[model samples]
Target chain A: MCGIVGLLVKKPELREQLGALMVPMLVEMAARGPESAGMAVFTAALPEGQRKYSLHAPVWDYDWGGFEGEFIKRFGPEAQLGVQGNHAILTCDEPADAVKPWVRGHFPMLHILAAGRVMDIYKDTGHPASVAERYRFGSFSGTHLVGHTRMATESAVTPDRAHPFTAGEDFCLVHNGTISNPYMIRRKLEHRGIVFETDNDTEAACRYLEWRMREGDNLETALGKGFEELDGFYTFLIGTQNKLALVRDAFACKPAVVAETDDYVAIASEFRSLAHLPGVDQAKLFEPMPEEIYSWTV
Target chain B: MDGVNATDRRRVFDLSTARVRDLNQFLHHELPGSGVEQVEVQHPGGRHAIAVGINHPVNVEVKGHGGYYLAGMNKLASVTVHGNVGWGVAENMMSGTVRVKGFASESAGATGHGGTLIIEGDASLRCGISMKGIDIVVGGDIGNYSAFMAQAGHLLVCGDAGHALGDSLYEAVIYVRGRIKSLGADAQEEEMTDADRAKVAELLARAGFGYQPSEFKRVASAKKLYHWNADANQEY
Candidate 1:
């Protein structure tokens, strides 16, 4: 089993407390998932033509200053990197298409967790609370975020296999159930020249949906296709540029509860995580129906 | 059953300071002769297995949202949760009444044997799966595949039901006041008689719902898939 937690602040002021409010929710679900924890936070977008590339190194004290100096030497003083624990957000005026290939060509050891104008990803294999502390999750400020705690049923327990798997820019998915036909989906995507990052089941699903979106289907239509093609028990909580969407499989094979108030909307695998939220007693609490997509925008 | 100095008839359990295990230990081990007829639990914080496995007659009120298995294996105890609950609330309950003032997650009263489980708000999927002799009343719509393979019981939903209301039923009966998306295999709707109406009325009254009995429809097993048939080739 795994735990999926998402929060989208309706009030702009609550965005500052997004990570603080979500850490408790994530920690409460450690009972459901204790193997690994990860999240994708959607911060304020950089100006047009700029992007943030989230990079993770194997060591906690990697020399980010040296890496930034090298990047500036190649691309001038336009690239700036902010280091946080083992994770760093490298902001550059270059688009993703330009920066990704260059980073991959130069630094083979650094894992690019995500690249987008607004989203920053941090994930590691550890207890959710400790991982949160390792990444300073309490001080994160964002309009919305999607987090996951994995029990690692189908894949190995590694930081790269941890959830909030991303596809295109600003899109990530965290899953709470296993997919039955991931190999089939993987074959379909790989046959189309789409590369997969890992053998994890959630990666297949994330790549599938994003492939559909790249091919012209919007999020809802791609999710409609996901309901048709993806065969298995899944309660997928997805994060986009400005939205948080949740969808359960047709069988309701996994559990998900949603609590929405005027201030924010919180989605978790169980209500146990949501009980600590502010104004939750008065919030409108309900479960999303099977196969229906519940989306909330920032 | 050691030295507790509670002289009041109503004892309160503050979950903020007291662990759920200790609170349950008090309800399980020392409450019979403790002279505390009512126990109120505060700050439940959505914890699991609160006030479970009670064998004596008592009143337990949970002040806020409870987690999974709020009152499982209950007997002769009336437990009320004033807020929402997580999965499997009052599962495998044998007797007495367990009520939730707010909504419940999946499998609300699964495999219950006796007593009444009432939800004033909606219940999620599989509300009363494999029930035996228990009664369930949902004030709002129930989710998909409710009452699946129920052996013997009465499930009353005052609101709409999602897909496959009763799948692979046995002797249990289902009375739905609102729309049923579909019925499961071998489960068919039958004409509601006066006795069925009276049964609905009694349960509704016991659960304090104001719905009229005439608004319901009955669903029971058709017994088609009861035995092995060699000629059918496994098509229902």
Candidate 2:
């Protein structure tokens, strides 16, 4: 089990304050998932350039220098490189539609996690506090953010196994349960040449959403498809730079609570995580209905 | 309150002083509305009524792993637990129901004045101890001394019962099938008549257990202990 949280704030000023507020909530849920923690922030873009999708993955065993040279040759000079441990972040200025096909065609061992302008994903092994420290996120600033604290159970415990996983550049997801049908769905996505990073089931969930989006389905529709296709227990929150969505499995085995207001929306694995939110009311305690899919756009 | 009381998170509360001070404080403490939703207690380490006396039409879900007297004295709330509950779950409950999806510790549904208590799994010793006007239906086997001293209402067990069932019972009818190791003082096995079979069948259906009433036997106190006769040196 893991702790997942997401908030869509109406005030842009709250963007920077989001990280500070999230730190306490994530820390309190340390018992739920103790392996790793990461947060993705989405802020409004000032430049309004073409949509960009970026995937950061740690390449292992292979020659790092040779891989970097080959990656630069494949994507050319537009690619920006940053290294963290064995991980590397490759980004480009091209539109997501133009960049995704090229990345899939070149990297046979990579999985795309998020596809959108202003997309950010951070993950590392250890507690949420340590992971946040690794990113030097003294204060996270974003209009909307999704955070995940992962406990490795069904999947191997590694930095790559962390949540807020992205598929292509426009879609990103964080999950709190197991996906029983991951291998089957992975095979299908592999047929489409979507590379995978970790052996985690969430990789299939990411690819599943990408598969639906590529087929011209909207985010909500793809989430609905996930309920029908993905098996096992899951209460997940998926976010892009422009959209936020919630999905519970048909059985609703895992727990997820939502507190909504006209000004903002917040969701978490437990109501206690939302207890410290400014306007929480005990009267609105409700669990998401089983098989229910909720979404919002900004 | 942000969540359950910080002090109560690790402290143990017993049946007499059982209180759920901040039951829904985590879920709806900041929202506006009266809509019913489910709240779960991840680890109920000997805490009572994580949801007791809730005034709203809510569904309180305790994900098992709980302690004594869960859902005790509940009113206007429906509680469903996913695991085994401790002694006296739904005790003194009024105007609402308590459903146990798994086994019960002991004395479940004790002295409940109203509402139905359904135990889908087996019940421990002293099951439904001193039940008064509550309708208790157990799907699986019940341990020894079930329905002992029950004053009123029905105690029905769908599976076999252990020793000394319905010891010194009065008013309440004890229905069980299969073997009984022994009977409590003033309690005895009776004939399984049609009326007894029908009553047991109805309770089984309501408790979501399908059973053949003919496979059960009726047990009740002989009422010899209800009054004192000064005639001989014998006391029933």
Candidate 3:
């Protein structure tokens, strides 16, 4: 089992409190998933001609400053770098496809968590509260955020196996239940030239969406198609650049509650995660129907 | 002066500080006829088993949602959830009432032997599977495979029912006001006789649902599988 939480701020005034509002929710999810935690925050859009890439290393002191100099030497001096906890964010004028290969060839130890204009992914293997504190999540300001506390069902406990697994450039997915046929799906996806990092079922599902989207299917279409193709019990919270989508299996064995208000829309594995949100009591609350796709945009 | 004292001052437990175990412990420890008649539970969403295994006739009012097994093995207590509930809200409940003002997740009243479980909103899959003698009244629709293998009980749905309304049912009576997508093994629709209507009316009134008894369609076992026949072996 795992716990998934997402917040989409419809009111601009509440955007600054996204992380602050999400911490308590994530902490409450500790009972469901205590192995590791991960989060992805979509901040304000980047400036024109710039893109951001979030990378992580195993240790806190991983020579991020030196890596920045090396990146500038290779990708030109127009790159800006900032390090938070074990993650390093690089904003550059170069496209991700061009920069990724160069970084991969040069720094094989670095793992790219997300590459997009608005999304920055932070994750680690620890208690949810400790991971949130390490990244200082309470001070973050963003239009939307999605987080996960993993119980390590099918994957290792390494930070790389933590969730909010990235799909395409700006897409990420967090899952609550195990997929029974991940290996079968993985083989099919591999035949279509989709590379996989871990043998985790969530990664397979995430890659399936990315593959479907790449083949001209929209997010909703991809999710609808996923419901037919993916077998097993699962509740997924998917994050795109500007949209957050939720989907559950037909049986809906996993728990999910959604609350929508004038200011924000939130979803969690249980209501406790949503109890502390502003205007929670007055917010409209309901469980998502089985096999239905519910999406929200900022 | 009234006999109410400080110990019976309507105990209030906040889930933020005291866990669900604390509340369940309080309810279990309270003996019959204890002065603690009313208990209010605040911040109820994240916890599980909030008032399980109770024997006293107290009232528990939870302020918000609840996790799995909210009132499992309940007896005599009247527990009310102002919000939704997770899986098996009142599993194996012997006697008492478990009410949810909002929705309930899968198996809302699984294997409950007796008591009343009321859901003001919809209930997910298998709402009353294996129920022995409990009475479940849902104000909204219920998901698929409800009342599967139920030996005895009464299930009342005010709204539509998903596919396979009652599979492998025995003795249990089902009443639905809205559409039943399909019926499961050994389950078939039956006539709502005068006695059945009276029973339905009594249950609806007990749950505060004002629907007329004539609107409901009754479902009961077909009684075909009780004694197996050699000719039916091929079908099996």
Candidate 4:
């Protein structure tokens, strides 16, 4: 059991309050998933010709004094790095494919959470309220965001096991149920030279989508392929740079509610997570049918 | 406002200050007689177990939406929600009536023993799962796996039903006016008799639904799954 929440602000003015509006929704989900909480925010695009990469370490006491000099020496002088809590965001003119491998070789302790133009991922193993406060999430400004509170049904209670798992480039996914055939699917993807970070089933699902998209499938087509291959009771909220999509398994065993209004489109595991959204009282509320993909974009 | 009479004084409970426990405590404090016969609950959204375990005959009107197990183990109390409801709206209810003016989530009346549950809008998955002896009426559609493992009761769906209706059903009777996508293990559609039509008509009228009894179909257990045999194991 887990809680997933996604918000796509239709009005640009509400972007700054995205995190503020999301706090109550995340906190309400504490009952569903008390083990860990995570979020992915899609803010304004990166500066021209620059790419942003989010990195996560176990502790905030990691050395950062020589980080800028090291990055400059490896890549170029156009690199900029900043540390907030246990997360670090690095912006550079180099491509992600070039910087990612070099960063991994230099910083063995750091795990790349997300590397994209508009996405920044933050997560930790703690209560949702405390984690949100620690990261000062209320001040975050973004066009859209996706969050997850994990109950840790199968994986260890580690920060890396937390959700909003990044798929490819700017895509991320948060899942609620388990996949029964993940090992078989993982082997199949591995045979296709697709690398995996964690043994989490959700990661396999995300990577499967990434592989499909890499083979020239759009988000909708990739998801349609997933419906045919994936087996289990699952409700997924996937986030791209411009779109947020929701899909439930054919059984629809997992719960999901969608509320749409003039200002925003919100999706959550239950209505309580969406009860406080603006204009929610007048919003159109309905349960997403099984195997149907519901998506909204900027 | 509508059900209140001259003898019964209505008391308003603001959930902002008084929690759901307080509301239940106020109702259960007096066993046989809680002079307050009518309760008006305000700001009821995001709260669970609003008026559970009520023994006395009272009327509760929730002004807004409700959370899980809104009226579990209720007895002799008529609970009404003006807005939508979360999962298990009247789970294991013993008696009285629970009505929702809006939609209801999964497991609306799960394992209810005896009572009347009415949902004016659609009900999500598992509307009457494992029901023992209750009467549930849904004015709109219901999702998959409804009436699963039901032992005894009556479920009346006015609209379409999703996949796997009455899976592993035992003794419970189901009347669906719209399409049934599928039936679960050991459950089969039976010919509706005159008595079944009368029962369906009465339940629909009681729930304030206008539908012809002739349009409905009855579903019951085939009694083929009560015993196990090695030859029947192939069917498994």
Q: lDDT tens string, model 3, A15-119? A: 889999999999999888998999999998898788999999878988998899898888899988888967989999988889888888999889989988999
What C-alpha lDDT, on a 0 to 100 scale, does residue A200 get in candidate 4?
Answer: 92
**Residues A153-253, model 4: lDDT tens digits:** 76898888899898668889999999988888899999988778888989888889878988999899999999999989799999999999999998887
Clashing pairs in 4: none
TM-score per candidate for chain A alone: 0.98, 0.81, 0.98, 0.97
lDDT (Cα, 0-100) at A198 in candidate 4: 88
Q: After superposition, how far is residue A250 of candidate 1 from its true place, in Å?
A: 0.6
DockQ of 1: 0.73
Ranking by lDDT: 1, 3, 4, 2
Q: Give the per-residue lDDT digits (tens) of candidate 1, residues A175-252.
A: 999999999999999999988878999999999999999999989999999999999999999999988899999988
In terms of docking quality, model 3 is: medium
Which scores higher on DockQ, 1 or 2? 1
* Winning model by lDDT: 1
Clashing residue pairs, backbone N/CA/C < 3 A, model 3: none
The alpha-carbon root-mean-square deviation between model 1 and the true structure, to one decimal in Å, is: 2.0
Give per-residue CA lDDT, model 1, range B1-236, as digits (tens): 24545556688998878999999999899989877889999999888999999999999999999988999999999999999888898899999999999999899899999999999999999999999989999999898899999999899999999888789999999999999999999899999999999999999999999989999999999988789989989888
Q: Tens digits of per-residue lDDT for model 2 on A1-298?
A: 7989887776666676777767766765666788898777785552566454435545533344565676667667656655444444555556666666666787655545555666667777888877777665447677677888998877778766788787765467888888898999999888988778778988789878977998999888888888788888898888876877888876455656666765467777765566566655422334465577788776
Model 4 chain A scores worst on lDDT over the 10 consecutive residues at A59-68
The CAPRI-style docking tier of model 1 reads medium
